[model samples]
Target chain A: MAGLLRRDMLGVALTVAAIMLPVAGAQAADPIKVGVTITQSPPGSVVQGTQVKDGLEVAAKIINDAGGVDGRKIELVIEDTQGLPEKARAAVEKLATRDKVVAITGEHQSSAALAGIEVAHRYKIPYINTNGWSDVIREKGYPEVFNPGNYNSRVGAAAAATMKELGVKRVVSIAENTDYGIGLAKAIGEALKKIAPDVQYKYETLDRASKDFLPAILPMRANAPDAIINLMLPPAAYIMMNQLYEQGVAPSAKTWLYDGSGLADYPDFWQNVKEAGKGMLVFGLYHPKMAQPALGKQVGEAYTAKTKNEPNRLLFQAADSLFLIADAIKRAKSTDSGALIKALGETKYTGTRGEITFSKDKGYAFNQWLDVPYVTFQLTEVNQKVGDSALVSQAGQPLDPAKLWKPAK
Target chain B: MSGIDVDLAVNGLITGVFYALMAIGLSLIFGILKIVNFAHGEFYMVGAYAYTLIALALGVPVWIALPLAFVVGALLGWLTERTLMRPLYAGYTSWGLMRDEYAVIVTFGLSLFLINFVDKVIGPYAYRGPPLVETSRVVLGPVLISGHRLLAAGIAIAVIAVTAALIKWSFWGQQIRAVSQNRLGASLAGIDTAKASVIVFMLSGGLAAFAGALLSPVINASPDVGIFPAIKSYIIVVLGGMGSVPGAIIASLFLGVIESFGAVYISFQYRDAFGLILLMLFLLFRPQGLFGEKGREV
Candidate 1:
């Protein structure tokens, strides 16, 4: 009787061990899903979307090649928002519930980002803003949302400082009718008021849909400002720049053409602007001359090798976005939403650009990678590459006016 | 007037010429079908792409490419009428039997399809057309205009004159007018009413496409490039008295000058608003429009 009882106990223990081990193994091997929302069609900036998509894909490949995080692959579930607010909201909802992604990232447009964050907050999912520069995104103070790219206030201060250094008393910003464009335009105005009190500044908001801006541009001919700042995205920015050049408005000896939209890095810049881009000062987010981590070089080289086009700032920002998510997952040791959010908040990961860490402070600084580096450069010749352009200002440094160029009328 | 005002007026008139070209086609479509072609903008977009690609990509001369673009647009217009638009008036003996709602739904759907088709196939990139002239800048008294724009405006005037003449005096022109006035009566009088409808669509398509090709140099061609022009065309069609080609021409010029001057004197931001205000004022006071006759036939 005693031997029979011992045999029954041994058999039950063996059965339990066999069932539990395989379940744990399957869980460990399952891929972790991340969500990406970007514009892939018209009425939105497709160029930005294509760049971000390429960047994320490159980073995903790098991670998988490095055996991924804890031996599980990072799978991206992408949705095309077309840069519409309603589309973005639905995309986040689908990503969180249907795709069951651990986190959401790669939103480049500010208006889309604003809509996306609401859904992320509702679902308590982690959202990393890749390129949406509007300060209002960070100002909302949503715990789930984080920004690791450039912000409007940063640009506003930088632009104000540059204007002061150039000693331009009168400035005009031809802004596109969008959150990013108008926000930066207003931010610059505020910054100018504080830092360069004597400088005269005003901004004209143009409909993004309207192709003709001659009316707004022609009036400036009679009383041309000292500097004309572009606060619009291409191809609208390209159109505006060409129109400005055609009207003898800027890049001339008397007036400087300052690009606040970081338009120089776009692949189609020279193709669209041609001679109009010459002698223009650019607010560059990623210059080839700037110091970056080894990962940055890897991603940039991979992007060029794949696309056969030079790397832009959006690539590094997008790569860093994905890397931050993967790093958070590894640190948390789980794919649970609460754990992922907590891990992301406490992240201090070395990414493609630099050692990225979220800020604990409130307002625009909260959960933002505050020290995103930038540089100022000048396009001295038509069809000049961003790498070949002269860097007039380095990260955290003032612009050197002597290094700048203006076309002689 | 100051030099700036003179410059504004000159630019306004030039713009008006292009607007007249676009509006004439839309007016013709409305006159014949009594339903506005919602896809009128896509026709323009197609022409812009055709001209740009033919000249820059295929190494064709600008003069040759310009006419070829119009031909392409005319062919597209003909095809659209033969296929999608035929169902609206097919087998229907009278205007009252026609499903007017079908025209709206089909044209709107067609517009969306064409925009997306171009976007996907051609990719969402803007291609700047080659300039008709090599000179970059041309000084015209008080204004500094680009050589391409000045030349394009000249071509636009000639095209408008030719189109107007064709509609007024040509053999096909008289048939189109007769059909537009009374489709059933024109059919009864031995005029092939369907053929006249086809010609109107072709002419409308050709003119709109020509306008697009002309402006491609200034406004780079993208997928949805026709949206703004299409909206303006709607307003112009109404302002000019729905079906009057000459009225369209005059209204186009008037709106252009008002917008140009209003943008400068009143507010640049409200430049579009000025046109809307005019439209509202006209709708309230003169519902029949500048040239449109009062009352609709049941």
Candidate 2:
């Protein structure tokens, strides 16, 4: 009787193991879906979107080539936001609920990012902001969101410091009517007030959709400021810059044109601006001469190999964004949102740019990689590449006026 | 007037010249078809891409590429009229009730199609067309302008004059005008109304495309680059008079000058709104527009 009872229990245990083994194998073989929201088409910046997409793909290829995280492949489910808030909200909702992605990332535009984070927060999914520079994104204090990209305060302080070093008394910002543009404009104002109180600063918000800016620029010709800061993005920024140059308002011997929006790194920058871009000061997050980690080199090489174009800051930020997600998934050992969020919070991973660790501080610093490096440079010639441009200032260094070039009126 | 005011006026007039280029084509289409062609802006967008790619990618001379853009746009307009617009006129007489709805839906669809098609085929990167001249800045006393812009403005005035003359004197233009006045009467009078419609579409497309090619150096040609111009064209069409060519030209210049002055004096932020406000006033008070005759249907 004892032998028969033991044999039956062994038979039941064997049957259970047979069912569980295949299930485990299938789970290990499954691809981990990461949601990506970007403006694949305009009226948003498709250039930025394309760059971010390329970077994410490069990072994904690297991860998968080396046998993806914990024996599972990484699959990106992308949705087009078209840089509209309503579209972004819908995209995030679709990504979180419908697609059931583990995490969401690759949002470059600030207004879209702001809208996307709300849906991510409600769904309690981890969101990695790629290149939205608005501080309000961090100020919202959503635990689900993590900013591994540049923020407005950092650029504001940099621009202000550059202005102070250049000793410009009056500065004007031609900002677009978007959160990123307006926020950075205000941020620069705040920073200038703190560092150079005597300097007069004002920003004019322009419609991003409008093609002409001659009217706004005409007034500047009457009594041009000492310096003009560009807080707008292309192609509006390009038009504004051309108009500014045509009106002899900025970038002249009397006034300087400082680009706070990192427009110099764009592939179409020279093609669009041409002579207008010459003698312009740029607040750049990535210069070919800047010191980068091994991971950065690897990503840059891979990107150049894939695209034949030079690697820009958005590429590194986007790659880092995806790498951070993969790192969190590896540390957590699970695809669950709660586990991923917790793992991401305690992240100390070295990404493409550098060792990225999220800050615990509130406001703009919350969950942000605070020490993202930057440099200041000047474009001295028309149709000049960013590599050939003179680096006026290195990261964590003061601007050298000797290295700067001004247009002789 | 102050130097700035003179600057504003000169710049405004130049801008108005380009506005006239876009508005004239739209005005012509409305005059003949009596239904708005929503894809009018896409014609401009296509011309922009055509000119930029021909000059930049194919290494064609800017002068040749400029006219080629017009030809491409005209071809597109012909094709659009042949395939999409014919259904509105063919196999249906007195279909005025469905005309507006059908035209709207079809043209709107075409606009979306063209935008997405260009975005996919050429990619989303903006291409700035090469300037006609290498001179960056041209100063005329108080006025400062790009050499390319000055030349383009001059070309625009010439084009507008030629177009107006053609409409007033050309044989096809008279037929188009006849069709505009009374489609049924023109058809009964042995005028090839369909041919007239086709010609108007082609001319409209060509003119809009010409404007686009001319401005591509300044605007940077992209998929959605035509959207703003299209909006401006719409306002000008109404403010000038829906189907009056002379009215469109006058209104275009008027709107441009007002916006330039309003931007500096009133608020730069409200520069675009100034046109819309004028459009509203025109719609409410002068529904017939500056030159449009009220209750003129035969």
Candidate 3:
């Protein structure tokens, strides 16, 4: 009886192996799908969305060209969120449930990212935040969420340090009323309090949808601050800058205009602002003159060739997002959510920008890349390209005020 | 008054001039059809693109480009009326019952289509039209304004005056007023009501487009650039009295000044809220508006 039972168990084990091996082989041949949520329509930052989409496409191409991850090609399933939170939530739901993407990434708006992460967390999918800078996103502390791009706290510290070096007594930030804008504004204030406690700082929130900002700008004419930081995105930023110039506010001899929103690298910056952009200082994530990794150089060249436009920070941030996902898949050796999450946490891969590693620390540092490189530059002339702009400061260097330019009032 | 006050007033008035240009068209549409043209803003957007692309891409002079924008808007207005709007009043017996709903849906759909069409076709990047003047700043006492803004404001006044004159005296304008007053009566009196409707739409489109072309330098032309101006125009039309041209002009200036002062004294964040508050109050207490008759029948 014992010999008969042993033979039966052996026969069942052999049958299971025969059934599972072919299914596993077939699955390995299928492409790995990654989900992207971005604004492709009006009322959102379509410019930023387009740049991110282009970067992701370039990265996917490069990955596939290098024989892909274990012979499986990368496929991206994209959805237009139009930069709305509700739409983003629905998009993530659809992608995770219907499309069955392994990992979700490429969200540029903070509100959208915040909404998307909830669904991603619920489904236990790995979520790489591309460019949502709000600190609240980090504070949520979801195990599934990882940030390899810039954050509001990082920019706030940078802006404060630059303001201190410039020796500005009074500074004002004209921030748009959004999670990214308001969070960055508050971050700047907190950083200023630590670095330069005596520096008078305040932020005014403006409606992003409103075209005319003269009313918000007009009062500043009577008492212009030593430095005015622009925390709004275009074309609202462009409108505000023009109005400020017309009202003789900032970028003048008495006041310094600094852009913390990385507006200098936008393709439409010069055409939209024209003379108003001259003499403005910009906080940038990517500069042509800045030293970058070889991967960064390749991505930048590919982006320029593809779009006939200059490489921007969004392009690099977005590329890094995709590369990190591919790297995780390769390390994990499986498309399973738990395995991918574990691999991503342990990642120490060098990406397009630089070495990226997710922080296990709590609060804003949780799952965040803490040491992203940045630079300060000045647009010295009208229609000045980001490459041609004066790089006043590079990563780990103090902003040089002498390198700055002021408009003759 | 303080220098800021002087600056605010001048800026407000200048802003009001542009608002009047947008609101007048909306008012005209409301007068004839008794239904708002939700796509009225797209007319303005089309004009902006027409003026900017004509001048920048085609190398046309800014002066010619500006008027050409108006003509383009008029043509769009004509097309919209002939193709989409004609179904409401022209021989469709079942459609007459759903005229108001049909107008709303059609116009709203047109607005979305135009915005996305422009976004996909022309690309999402914004383009600033060349200013009419090169002078950046022109200071008059405490008021320091941009040369282009001051010039544009002057042109807006002239256009508004001419539009008012034509509407008050022109033969076509009289026919339009007749149709707006009583569509059934006007048709019975051999007023050629369809012709009047077409003319109103064309004129409405032209004015809104002219405003867009004039302000493109200041606002920068983008796909959703028309949305804000459209909202403001709606508020102005209601405050000034629906379908009243003079009321729209007066209400626009009033709202602009109120916003300017309120932004400084009350709160800059609530500046836009002031218009909405006024709109709400008007709807609740006086829905007839400042110049609108409460109820009129043939």
Candidate 4:
């Protein structure tokens, strides 16, 4: 009878061991795959893409090192859109269907983002637009989409305010022939009409793909505008700046070259533009001196360690995108598309830049970070670091003329 | 004319010169091979990268780098003709019915391959080639121009003249002309038609590459930088009369001036459209172009 009892106990222990083995495997859980679409090749701004990728990578490492969200490591599935709309659409579609990413994020170019979001909306996957500034993006009002980055209207308002502060009567905006460039150019004009009615604002749309802007720019030299705002991205922007400077058009005593594209923050800004960048006012989203969250400081430090490059606005935006996605996953307690979207909608997490919260208002503010911090700084000398540059305006502050630098005639 | 008008003309003329350099090569290939080289733009791209990288990375002088870029482009063209173009024409008319379609597919595939290959290898960053002259600006009368632009414009004029003279007087040039007029007849008459095709391709590649190297500083060497120039060259080629070197030069200048003036008075957004519009009008009215022969010669 005792031998029979020993055999039964042994069988019971074996059954328990079998049951616990599967449970332990389930507890480990698979990595939560997130899709990222960025411009990794030409015709798109690869510089921006590289920076965004590094930022996402840095943030992912930090999250995984901290044991990941809800014990599932974050995995970024990056796709190169080549800065083309069709490619972006295809990339998002492939990521959503084939890769089975839990969430999609990291679209930096506005044109590509505009295309990628449509696919994300159709699939009902949560999309966090990292840096597309086009106002039309939010106006689409996709419930699945969230923007924690800069917007065109905010830059428009800031540019208009600066134009008023500088007391410029005539402003010409040379914008790229794209949704971001044209939309932002129009927004600036509207803002100018409301704020400073006396200002004469007219915008010229140049094909971003076309390398030569001399035909468009030469006409400007005959009647130089008070302030020539750059609404284009590099390397086109760099070419335009060089040509303008070579022609003695802007950044002179008579005219101010105000950059609304936040160009100075780019890693290649100084190398490409050289002396032309001097005395040019930049609408900056990030500065070394700006106040950031503890997480922001940590991410910035970690990014510098990884890329050996100074932290820029896109870096913070990209980091915040991943953090928000991770935060949503934690709140939802599941990676279901519907649950993640709901969690992202109610996001109030403190990210790298500030305490992030998305507004539900229509137009530019729809699911957008309404209080995105920005400042206006001018490069006073060649190869000037963002820290060394003079900041003429701070977050929610008027322009300080005393700190503004102008090129001597 | 106002100051802007003169500025537009000068800039237009300079731009036209670059367009002509690119178009001449495409014209030559069409004259000899009777096939549209869709990979022509990539040849320009290769040249731009070659010039920029050699000067920037290898520490070579800009002048030497410019010629080296041309040589690289010529070599690339020769190799492409040998490997890709050889298969298309070998069994072409004698056995195959899809020679035209095959040629299109092969050249198009070659174009995509080169673009992606370079993008992967070099990384997608644009590099500005060092200018021949360090001086930034050179004022001429009322209009102001960059020193590099002025220097490049002069060099282009000289190159075009040399290329035109060579094609008109040289033995190889006469042989290319004969092959273009009657390929079978020329082959029967003891002219090496294949050799003429190879020579045309090399010359074409060299000229396009030279143009790319010259404008690298202004345009900044990127993978897709060739696309814009290639489009302009296509329009100029058709407008000037395909396979007509002089016609390409004249049409390129005309198109450039019209585009410059049109951008200012009409719309800068539609500047590129002007060429397409002119191309359409020419296609409708003058199908043979300014200097093209009335009958198609195979």
TM-score of each: 0.96, 0.97, 0.96, 0.94
Q: Tell me the deviation in Å of residue A45 in model 2.
A: 0.3
- Per residue, candidate 4 scores C-alpha lDDT tens digits across A356-384 of 89898888899998999988888999999
Model 1, range B79-135, lDDT digits (tens) per residue? 999999987898765688899888999999999999989988987778888889967
Ranking by TM-score: 2, 3, 1, 4
Count backbone overlaps in model 1.
0
Clashing pairs in 3: none
Model 4 error, position A141 (Å)? 2.4
lDDT of 3 at B289: 82
Per-residue CA lDDT of candidate 4, range B1-298, in tens?
8878898998899888888888999998887777788888889989989998999899999889999998999998889888888777764332124366677889889888888788779866677778889888888887899899899999989989999999889998899888887777787888887788788888888888888899888887777778887888888888988888999999999988998899889988899999999999999999889898776743
Give candidate 1 regions above 4 Å deviation: A1-26
Model 2 score (lDDT) = 0.92
lDDT of 3: 0.92
Among all windows of ten consecutive residues in candidate 3 chain B, which has the lowest summed lDDT? B91-100
Candidate 2 DockQ category?
high
Going through the candidates in order, the fraction of native interface contacts each one reproduces equals 0.55, 0.85, 0.87, 0.71
For model 2 chain A, where is the 10-residue window of minimal lDDT? A400-409
Ranking 1 against 2 by DockQ, winner: 2
DockQ, Cα level, model 3? 0.84
Off by over 4 Å in 3: A1-25, B92-98, B296-298
lDDT of 3 by residue, A92-129 (tens): 99999999999999999999999999999999999999
